[model samples]
Target: MDETVQKSCWGVTAKAVIGLAGVILLAWLVIGSESAAMIAQR
Candidate 1:
């Protein structure tokens, strides 16, 4: 029973980490695209 609870908590933590990483990657992509577009206008 305790092991099951631990596994659930670990899964949740892993999901949170993955979600945060995804958000960061998305933000980087958006910013990078914008910068590239701006440079192309020059």
Candidate 2:
């Protein structure tokens, strides 16, 4: 039972990471100029 719970938690975390990455990509595409300026500032 503990192992199954741990696996479920891990799966949720993985999905969250993937979703975040997708959102970041979409934002980068939409805000192309701002993203480029930020990168240049760094």
Candidate 3:
């Protein structure tokens, strides 16, 4: 029973890491497009 609990905790941590990475990528993509457009205006 203890081993099962450990395994579940590890799985939850891995999922959180993946979710954070996805949010960072999305923010970069949105900001990058706007920055490019501003530069092009000059």
User: Which whole-number lDDT from 0 to 100 does residue 27 have in model 1?
Assistant: 100
What 10-residue stretch in candidate 2 is worst by lDDT? 28-37
Predicted model with the maximum lDDT: 1
Q: Taking the tens digit of each residue's C-alpha lDDT, what string does model 3 give over 10-40?
A: 9999999999999999999999999999999
> lDDT of each prediction vs. the true structure?
1.00, 0.96, 0.98
TM-score of each: 0.88, 0.73, 0.88
Error of 3 at 12 (Å): 0.6
Question: Which tens-of-lDDT digit does each residue in 1-42 have in candidate 2?
Answer: 999999999999999999999999998887998888899999
List the candidate 3 regions with Cα displacement exceeding 4 Å.
none
Off by over 4 Å in 1: none
Q: Give the TM-score of candidate 2.
A: 0.73
Between candidates 2 and 3, the one scoring higher on TM-score is: 3
Q: What digit string (tens of lDDT, one per residue) describes model 1 on residues 1-42?
A: 999999999999999999999999999999999999999999
